[model samples]
Target chain A: MRLEEKFKKLKQEKKKAFISYVPFGFPEINMTGDICLTLQEAGVDAIELGIPFSDPLADGPIIQKATNWALDKGANVDLFFEEFSKFNKKLKIPIVIMSYYNPILQFGLKNFFKQMKSLDISAIIIVDLPLEESQPYIKEARKWNIDNISFITPTTSRLRVKKIIKYARGFIYYVSVTGITGPRDLSYSQLSKHIKNIKQNTEVPICVGFGIHNSNQVYRINKFSDGVIVGSEIVRFIENNYCEKNFLNKLKTHTKNIISR
Target chain B: MKIPNDKGYYGEFGGKFIPETLSACLEELEIAYAKAKKNKNFVNDVNFYLKEYAGRPTLLYSAKNLSKVLGLNIYLKREDLLHTGAHKINNALGQVFLAKFMGKKRIIAETGAGQHGVAVATVSSLLGFKCDIYMGAEDVKRQSMNVFRMKILGANVIPVVTGAKTLKDACNEAFRDWVTNVRDSYYLLGSVVGPHPYPMMVRDFQAVIGKESRTQILKKEKKLPDYLVACVGGGSNAMGLFHFFFNDTRVKFIGVEAAGFGLNSLNSASLSIGKPGVFQGANSYILQDKYGQIKNAHSIAPGLDYPGVGPEHSFYKKIKRAQYVSVNDKQAVAGFNLLSKTEGIIPALESAHAIGYLKELAKKQKNSLVVVCLSGRGDKDLDIVRNYNGIKL
Candidate 1:
């Protein structure tokens, strides 16, 4: 099924999709499964499982720390799948493993796709893998029935937008800011205009990311896009307050508060 | 002789005492570096580049006119004469060569004033590796010559529009890129900051400055300098020069951080005003608020406007091996103008911070020999100077 159709289906059911991004094997390798379970239990609609790579260019200070921790615990492709296998029980949300191309290449493409399919990853967002450079991976992802989430930055030209929107399966990641993934002021009119442009160009669901930090930004973004992603801010929250006894509940509450009407 | 704990801590300043999330990564690097350093071949390879490519053993030139003007002898550690016109090349060469030795094929780096990007790109060009440089959009605009230089060297320069669109955003972007592409790429940090290995490795590479200066001073004056002066952005050049004299209590090391307006005003004098905290990996003195959140640091010299200083420099300041001083924009400009007219050497605005304090120090101290690190040439800063001088170039 196309990601656009999936997004529309969720909306028709009056369900808002929540995509949680946490570094793979963060805090500790043992903590990975528990964090996933907590997110799944807290009613996360979808999960973007980030395989912690040492050199993450699109992340912020919080995610950087998470990547460092994950790498320190000997997290790699082997550990990634190993961790995923621990959550063998049925998950509530669609699990999408978000990673850069280097790790996948290191693991070998043929085996990687096969593992993703077996692990039941619904989608993949390979950051830095532009459409022009992603033909082989996209083909493999499609063969495995794994949806490919394409990224479109504010600086992305109109022609590039059309190409990405035409082929994107799960959704089109609209980078609200012009730069790397972090918090900044959103140009609502520009964003809405871009959304409308994408809506006009293709049928894919548009999900905005790269700086929807506070509740106000989420509420604002929720009105315009099919779904919203809060990666760095949540990562920052975890960094600041993860060890607390009520951390999971606090996260759930924060999510609820942001999406509340 | 002992490697400062696993955290790379040097007297509480260099610890990787971050949140648990990054501890593993730091440990991985620590182990890797320990092994890498032991490999004699790796040391030789990095040393080869240091000698051949970065124009190592940079000269110790006596600032003849400045000495005459101030009535005190002043010698300059000419890091400005390095391959990329700054001391940044020394570390870039070392780090990138190490990346190649580690079998990493791709390089990702961040730049503020673009000196580091230019240096990294220049090294990557020679190493035949794919290179990506993350720079703030504002920095790209301000340092367009360097942007052009990096692009010409075949490195992809990605403009980061996040945050204030300065060094901090560039750092964030670089970290994000690293998180995504860690396996096949190495993050070439611009200074002696970041996680373990980087701070130590960069300092080791840049330490040649002090090594050369110490020898030159002994040969010329038959003694060590009474005072060593250098500007601190992330404190690389300062660290390089001061590390050799660290044990020498007689040679006073004075590091001038940019006080944008003043220390009390908005500025990047992190060492003077900042409190200790864990940021970007290492525990160091950083410009932070009462809540311990990193504060925005401002400076006219783009290179000196960092929110934090190197962990080693922070430690040195705490223990009094080095004294941290702040130089404001007006003073730096005066220093720049003075050096250009008197010495015919246009030092980088970052280096001007140290120069800015020299006149006052010369006046205060009687017959004291001062060695200031001219960390970079000012060719890239000519445009900014032209604007400030109101003269068409």
Candidate 2:
């Protein structure tokens, strides 16, 4: 399904979206497919699969650790697509590839988007490709009928937010804090206001991420925004429990438990 | 009419390829800096600090002996004699003034060789602002003395033990810090790389080197030098000297990049062996494998150990305005020793790369008037040199 369709269905059901971001090839390169299949089974509305790069400046220690693990295991763009192709057909929910811009540029943007189209991937989030340099990405993504997600942070001014959402494609990634992705004490009162301010400008769904680590945060954040993205928390879960035999079942229960909240 | 138009693109190279969190901050910073540039008080304050606190108009001495020996008209732009013993202080003092003008009480910077770190720490101390420096953990070990000096200047030296464990990682850590604290702090970038405003802003700050050298050379030689040379890491010092001479069609610019072992080995010669790719928030020539994952850059000089060069340097290289050449570890060391003996001035390993390329330059261009930007002193690199040459004393 397209990302818009997923959000529309969730809106019709009066349900908030539960999004999970897992670094590709975390435990093992081949294990990415299983994780995606598991995430979809675990009641995730959408999955944000990370393309690990050498330098992830926007990430905290947790994601950085995962990036290192993935790269050490010889995970590259081609390997990610090749390995994930097995489960791409099995995935029912929309999947977005989260990558820094260089890999996509190096992989050739036209070819990358074509590969994504082939895999039925819904959207792409280039973390570093800001509004200023996004014209090429936007034009190419549009050609591929791919929704290129744009990011807005709490630090973004109201005017800039309006300007960014003007070009926002599928959904706007609302970084809940003024920092990189990590678990931190976030004031929902302030965040809710930020979300409300964004909602006033665009009717597009806003998914909040960064500094959200627990179900409690997912619950609270879901109250204000259309979706909640759990990254470091889920990555931490996988990092700690991937060795266990019943990890997938536990992940389903954990994800189900979080969603029901 | 100029490069890096309002949007900050040096041809197709530079843009604000940063995170959304830093968008407003950088935009505000760019606007604020623009206003500050026009405001006489701000400009005067920066000039005052540059002259009074940091030291400016550093002598441009003609290296008669070295010039005679090499059969080239060689002159040295003595930035090593600046207050912080490197051209870095010029930018540090200027940016801190801008930080102060913008009401930011805290300053953050990333450093590799510790020259920029020490310069920033010293300026931050003099200006009474809270300062934090992010340096690679490996750099902290290699440049322990400069780290100690930074601590003595009351700047918190934070060691980054991330990717490559060197300058590249330090840059990553610093960007992380800046993104995290974009609310109340200012990121005083030490080089002419990074997202939009930084490359242009740093170039403007360090343009003092180019300005002073150009003025001094005209007064002394009554004509422009045929060649302007400086070592390129993130390419600040080279840009510092090269920016002034950019339009001087007759003057050739040579930027020396560090080749760790050799051109074929693990090296920091991104301009030589790398492809155009985005790293550190700007699109530039970066050392990367076929997968586009940034390759680890190595050099005997920690400062030159970077995977990417500045976007402006990329633009210059593309336009054939400046010539970039690589000098290996042995060549740089030899250059360091030669300059020490011939000119009686010990040059920083980073600066020595320029000298290393001089012999190569002289062989091609005969009796050419050359101006080499002696970007820093060798005090910060004594240990590495002593260890390399097996000098126990």
lDDT of 1 by residue, B1-393 (tens): 453555477787675422222333344556666687788987898788777877778889998898888877899988888888999988887777678767888999999889999999999999898999999898888889999999999999999875567887688677656654555667889898876667888888888899899999999999989999999989999989988887778999999999998888889998888877656666688886542335677887888877888888887887788889888988998899889899999999999999999987887896789899999999888887778778975
lDDT of 2 by residue, A48-129 (tens): 9999989998999999999999999999999988988888878889999999988889999999999999999969999998
Q: Lowest-lDDT window of 10 residues in candidate 2 chain B?
A: B48-57
The residue pairs in collision within model 2 are none
Residue runs of model 1 more than 4 Å from their true location after superposition: A1-261, B1-3, B17-25
Query: What is the lDDT for B283 in model 1?
Result: 69
- Residue-wise lDDT of candidate 2 within B141-188, one digit each (tens)? 999999999999999999998887899998898899999899789999
Question: Which 10 successive residues of model 2 chain A have the least lDDT summed?
Answer: A252-261
TM agreement with the true structure for every prediction: 0.64, 0.98
Q: Candidate 1 chain A vs. true chain A: TM-score?
A: 0.93
lDDT of 1 at B288: 61
Estimate every model's Cα lDDT from 0 to 1.
0.78, 0.91
Error of 1 at B237 (Å): 0.4
Native-referenced DockQ of model 2: 0.88
Q: What fraction of correct interface contacts does each candidate retain?
A: 0.09, 0.87
